[model samples]
Target: MVQPAQSPEPDRSPGPARSSEPARPSDVPADHVVVLFGATGDLARRKLLPGLFHLARAGLMPRRYRIVGSAPAAEALTDQEFRTHAQQAVAEFGRSRPEGPAWEAFAAGLSFGAADTGAAEPLMAAVREAETALGGTPRRLFHLAVPPVAFTSVIDLLGATGLAADGKVIVEKPFGTDLASARALNAAIHAVFDEARVFRIDHFLGKEAVDNVLALRFANGLFEPLWNRDHISHVQIDVPEHIDIQGRARFFEGTGTFRDMVVTHLFQLLGFIAMEPPVALEAGPLRDEQVKVFHSMRALDPAHVVRGQYGGYRDEQGVDPASDTETFVALRVAIDNWRWSGVPFQLRTGKALAEGRHMVTLGLREPVLRMFPLETRAAAEGRSNELVIDFDDPGSITARFLVKEPGPSMRLADGDMLFNYRTAFSAQNFLEGYEHLLLEAMRGNQSLFTRSDGVERLWEVAAPLLDAPPAVRPYAPGSWGPDGIDGLVAPYRWHLPDRRDATP
Candidate 1:
């Protein structure tokens, strides 16, 4: 569903604030100004600032650079504090921390604004000032990295001040808590920003490995012809979190895996892998195809979806006891499309899972019938040609295919065509996920971002599931999820790694 970002290039425009555009441009220079709405929050402090800094480190900031972060808490915000803030993100997300002159250059490019102090006015002034300084028309990108609660306020202010209509606004996940809330938010956003101008953020789609799914299917040989129910028994999309709900317990309690992962993240990935090829890779065509996938998803009532909660985890330090939240989720979904019809697309995700992972596992059913005249039990169990794409740590891809053994009598054996990310490219060749996503956003490439319809479709499938009473079960915090998860992939025998530690 997502494509990896190319490295950062330099920002070349000559307009307002710090510069008119960002200082980097791995892709084409961004045509607009990026206004970061929540400049001082944990996300801004942790992911957003660091993400932008990484782009700058990669030399991807455009020529006319302006990073105007607007937070109601922005007033009284000092330049030194902003620098210290960015410095921390720099050390965290920036692969190689910049210091001395390089650090100064990067720091100089950043500027902050406060919402509490009437600083948003200054922020707008700064933006216009920067454009005036740059001597050209500049596009604008407003990244609403604020809390969901703050999103409405930010948009309201942006619109009140005429900033919202000036350019595009990039919104983060959990667009709404459920179908009703999502509709409300969409209506609110529609009031100011047109659907075309809104780009919802789904970071999963921007990963290098995820984007490779498209290339593997469309670009590779010997795949397109065999990519269907006859070939694929089912598909698996797993996005596990190794870390516990450290600080998100409050926000997460009101939400669960269905809202957290399935609605936007996993569903988007599914759409990409299952949707019809877009008439064109441009924003509208690509998004239209994905919207169709959403419409095609067999609307799951409460009966079709299942939820499991790990008991011991709530007793852990970070979780809440009164919570009924689901740390792990496994659901069997299907797309009513000719290509994926009858094939169950199992999506499993959780926080505090066995290990950290984000992967798409494709299981291709073996030949309908084997070489033997009368099939044996092994022959009945189709050989599974699995293609595993790992997005997080231990990144690599493994494709399992059937092969004939060299020594044994004409018997079929399974072998893997492995492509390890580490062995193929130096560890240094890879970029951080946050860095890649931020760069794409600045370059005006919405291809990696989620579309509005995509977001709504995800909710359509997940809202009913969330409302359904879950099949509650508990597992250890560090365990691989519920005990019965493996059964979902029963016929194919969920092929886990052979290593003992790999089970979790």
Candidate 2:
């Protein structure tokens, strides 16, 4: 049996002063044309198209907008052919099946252009056609969803052809192979478009749970006082996937789990968790705080890192038989700051694990005075008092603590107080990760996007591991990770996600 928790009264804390005046029409996003490069790729098909459709369905899209897709000339597709392909993709991958007037209106704006890096005429021609159809000179937003190797060339193409003039660009991540490349990429992008006009996408930051991290800390009075080293023993951020690389060996081989997941996703999440309170919730202030956290992070020590490769990874198509790529990585990170001086942030992510989970757990320190006796052997040894945030679909927050067991003897047992988003706010509509980010980009909000300095700082923090990466130990397909992982978090065990805690 389950009991529903009562909703608490609204907070009376004084927040940023607000103007009661209604927003002017100028606040609305201007009509724009989204030029999607690598339009035929997996990201476009699975996330971009469906995300756009969701925005359209929610009426969040501008009054008049167009989506122009561009791919290589060899994969050229006609206008109707591309529309048909997008229709199929949206139908298959969209949150809901395409139907009714919303789908029809969204489909009307779909068009395609086939062009390669060497040629820009085709892509520009498509943009012109879309502008003509829109009946105005709308703003242009270029979304580069291409491979990293093609980033500079496409950027150069955009610059040389004057397509980047007065237009914003959205770049997908694994921004660069390493620190030097990341810096070079930044230089090239800055040469073409100003930093303010660039939006570096990190879909993890767009998650509802991730966004709530700020509200959970700032909006509430219960957690702030205990957020520092004084109360928190260690922090663990774990993201493990059950499935292996689904035929993306070409990409995964070049970008292993460390670069793909650690530098990009895990570090970004860590920033949010450990960032200082911003003076304001605006883009600059918020981003400044996140960057400060990155600055405080100590460079990853190779001794504190664990790399693992799942068995049978080489059997996958396109993988090198002797590939040294890591499919699993566990690291111990330290943030040297007044607030988090002695705290250890344990981070781990892997593919082909026992189960799939995306969550962060903060282990609270043991009480100074221990007067009660524990009847259970597990409790006697010590059980972690934790605060867990689940980032899976329908996110949840849970607090694990000790409670008195009903018995003649004085004993204690672990109990959890959970708040699940789905049950607590059943009527609320949550946007998909990419959907939220795409909408924010269109609205010219760079708060959720990563900045150039932050990206470079992350690379610098991971430099040690990237330069002299540890040996990749082999692990079974369905295991948690290599046996060495346990050694990384000595004395403190990994917080294995409990399915029950996530259930509403």
Question: What's the lDDT of the predicted structure labeled candidate 2?
Answer: 0.84
lDDT, residue 215, model 1: 75
Off by over 4 Å in 1: 1-26, 74-76, 117-119, 316-322, 372-383, 406-413, 426-429, 498-504
Q: Candidate 2 lDDT, tens digit per residue, 1-504?
A: 111111112112232111123234554467888999999988999999888876665556677888989998998888778778888888888864566556667777878887776687888888888877776678889999998888888889899988899899999998897899999999999999999999999888888899889999999899988899999999999999999998999999999999999888999999999998999888899999999999999999999999999999999999999999999999999999999998989999999999999899999998999788755544654456889999876688999888888998777887889988878763225677888889888889999999999999999988988889999999999999998887788778887656876885
Candidate 2 error regions (>4 Å): 1-28, 375-382
Q: What does the lDDT come to for candidate 1? A: 0.68
Lowest-lDDT window of 10 residues in candidate 1?
A: 1-10
Best-fitting candidate, scored by lDDT: 2
Q: After superposition, how far is residue 364 of candidate 1 from its true place, in Å?
A: 1.5
Q: Please write out the lDDT profile of model 1 over residues 1-504, one tens digit for every residue.
A: 111122233333331111223432246465446677777677777777766655564466565565665666524355567777778776775555646544666566555566642345667765675455445677788888877887777778878888776588888888898777888888888889987777788877777777777777778777776678888888888777778767666677777777788887888888888877777777677778878889999877655555677666577555666667787787788788888889988888887777767777778775666554423333455435677777654366777666676785776565667776656754543446666677666666677777666676677776666666566677777777777776665665544433321222
